[model samples]
Target chain A: MITVALPKGSLLKDTIRMLQGAGLDFSGFLDSSNRQLQIVESSGRAQGLLVRAQDVPVYVEYGQAQLGIVGYDVLYEKEPNVAQLADLGFGSCRFSVATKKDGPYRSALDLPPHCRVASKFVHSARRYFQSIDLPVEIIPLSGSVELGPITGMSEAIVDLVSTGRTLKENNLMELEVLFESTARLVAHPLSYRLNVDNLSEYVDLIRQQVLVVA
Target chain B: MITVALPKGSLLKDTIRMLQGAGLDFSGFLDSSNRQLQIVESSGRAQGLLVRAQDVPVYVEYGQAQLGIVGYDVLYEKEPNVAQLADLGFGSCRFSVATKKDGPYRSALDLPPHCRVASKFVHSARRYFQSIDLPVEIIPLSGSVELGPITGMSEAIVDLVSTGRTLKENNLMELEVLFESTARLVAHPLSYRLNVDNLSEYVDLIRQQVLVVA
Candidate 1:
C-alpha cells in the first residue's frame, strides 16, 4: 500500500480535504478522538502518517512515505532531498524580518552590524542576510520568535507572518519580506523516479485536484 | 521589575504554584482565556514571559529574563550558557532508547553500527551513543518522534518517556534509559552574579520554598 505523510497542524484540514478530493479518505486523522498517528484510508489503497510540518519532508526523504504535504518554508529551511511534485497552493504565508515598531530600525538594512535577529528559520535568515551583504547574528529559537523583540533579547526577528496580527499585537512590524510560502506536494526522489507502488498515479490525481482548487 | 520566563506547557502549572509559594502570583498564565504571552502579577513587582520550554533558557541567557524555569532535558540538549540555579523537582521524566516490541534489538548495544536513531534531543542522544562507544545516525525530528520507529524511519527512538503509555500504545518498548530529567530553575549568569533587581532575593525565596515542598 502507498503511504502519504500529512502535516499535523494548520495545514491538516486542507490537506485532508485535498486527499479526499483525490479519492483517498484519510479523514480519520482529523478526528479529535482518533489518536493514531498512522491511519489507513477507507479503501485501504493508501495510508496517512500524521506528522509535524517540519517532519513531513524527513519521512518522504527517508522513503518511509512515498509522498508528503508540507509548507514551502519548511522545505526551504530543511533543504531535504525530496522531489517537488506540485504546489498545493493553500497555507499561504511569508518569511519577514520584524522588529519593535518603536525601535530605531525601519528596514532590514537599517539595523547595525552584528545585531541579533531571532528566528526558527535560522538558515533562511542567514541566507537572507548574506544575500543582502549584512552581518547579523541569527538566534535560533524554536517558538515565539515575536518574543525576541518584546523581551529585548534580540534587536529583530525573522519569522513567518501569516495575518500580521501576531506581529501587530506584539508591537512588531515587518521590515522586509524574504519570501512567500505555500503548502507544496513533495515525494521521495527515488520513489518518484521509479514510480514505486504506482505513486505517479496518486501524484497525478492529487495534482489535478489541487489545480482545480487553485 | 524582575522578569521571569515561564515555560508554556506541562511545567507551567507547577512553576506558577512554586512562584506563588515564593509570594509571586503569576497564576494568570494558567487561565485559558488569557491570550497574553506576557503577564504581570497583581502588584506588578514582577512580570512573566510565557514561552516554549526550549526557549526559556534563551530568554534568560540573553538577560531578557533574569530567571526562568525549564526542563533538564532541554538544557541537556541545547547546552545553553546559563547558570542552573535550582532543581524545581517537578515535571519528572526520562530519556530512553525504544524500539518496536517485536524487533530483533533488545538493547541499544544490540543495534547494528550506523543504525538510524531518531530524537528531538539529538545532542543528548549523540553524547549517550558516544559514551557507550556506539555509532548511530541520529535523525533530528521536531515533534511526534514516536512515529519514527513506527514508520520504519529509524531503528530506535531516543525520547522522553513519562508514563510509557505512548510507547506501549505504539507497540514499542524501552530498551535503555539514558537519563532522568526534571524541571529546573535557571538564571542568567551575569544577572545572578550582579544580583540585578535583587535577583538573588527572589532566587533564594523560590529555592527555600522548593526545598520545603521537596
Candidate 2:
C-alpha cells in the first residue's frame, strides 16, 4: 500500500479533494470526530498519515510515506531530502517581513544592524537577511508571531502572510515579501526513483488532476 | 502596567484561575468569542499576552512580559534565559519514552544503539539518553508524535503522557520516564532583579495563593 502524508491544517481540505480527483479517498482525516492520525482510504489502496505541515516532508523524506502534500514554505524551511513531484496549487501565501505600522523601518534594509526579527520560519528569515547582506538576529517563535511586534519583543517579524488581515489587525505592515508559496506534492527520493508500489502512476494521476484544476 | 505572558492552550484555564486568585482577572481570554491576543485585566493593573507554551519564556526573556506562565517541560527543552519563579503545581505530566505495545523493546536501554527516537523535547531526550550512555538519533517532530512509532518512523517516542489515553489508543506503551512536569511561573531575570513594576509583590501574592491551594 502507498502511504501518503497529509498535512493537518489549512491545506488539508484542498489536498484531500485533489487526491479524490486522482481516485484516492483519504477524507476520513477531515472528520472532526476522527482522532486517528493514520487512516486508510475507502479502497485501501492507499493510506494517509495526518501530520503537521512541517512533518509532512519529514515523513516523505524518511521513506515512511511514499508521497506527501506540504506547503512550499515548509519545504524551503526544512530542506528535507524529498523529490518535488507536482504543484497541487491550492494553498497560496507569501513569506514577508512585517513590522509595527507606526514603526520607523519601512523595508528589510531600513532596520538597523543586529535588529531582532521574530519568526517561525527562522531558516527562511535567516536566508532572506543574509541575501540582503544585512546583519540581524532571528528569534525563533513557534506561534502568534504577530505578538512579536505588539509585545516589543522584536523590531520586525518574518512570517507567512495569507490574507494580510492578521498583520493589519495587529497594527503591523508588510515590509517586503520574500516569496509566494503554494502546496506541492512531494515524494520520497528513493521510492520515486525505484517506482516502488507504482509510485509514478499515482504521481501522474495527481499531476493530471492538478493540471485539470489549473 | 505589568505585562504577563499567558500560555494559549491547556495551561491557560488553570493559569487564569491562579491569576484570578491573585486579584488579577484576565479571564477575557477564556471567552470563546474573544479573538484578542493581548488583553488587559478588569482592574487594568496587569495585562496579558496569550501565546504558545514554548513562546512564553521568549516573551518574558525579552522583557516584553515581565512575568509568564509556562510548562516546566518547555523550560527544560528550550532552556531559555529566564528566572524560574514558582511551580504553579497544576497541568502536571511526565516526559516518557514510549514504544509500540507489541514491540521487542521494554526499556530505553533495550532499544538498539543509534535507533531513532522521535520527540518534541529533543533537548530532554538527548540529555536523558546521554546520561544513560545510550546513543540514539532523536527525530524532532512538531506535533502528533505518537504517529512516529505507529508509522514505523521511530523505535520510540519521548513525549508527555498526561492520562496515557493517547498512547493506549495508539497501541503504544511507556518505556521510561524522563521527569515529571507542571506549570511554572517565570519572570524576566532583569525584571525580577530590579523589582520592575513592583514585581515581587505580585510574585508574593501568587506564591501565597499557590501555598493556600497546596
Candidate 2 lDDT tens digits, A1-214? 9999999899999999999999999888888898888888889899999999999998998899999999999999989999998888899999899999999988889999998999999999999999999999998899999988887789999999999999989999999999999999999999999999999999999999988998
lDDT of 2 by residue, B51-122 (tens): 999999999988899999999999999999999999989999988999999999888899999999998888
User: What is the lDDT of every predicted structure here?
Assistant: 0.92, 0.93
Off by over 4 Å in 1: none
Best by lDDT: 2
lDDT digits (tens) for residues B27-87 of candidate 1: 8888889988888888889999999999999888888888999999999999999999999
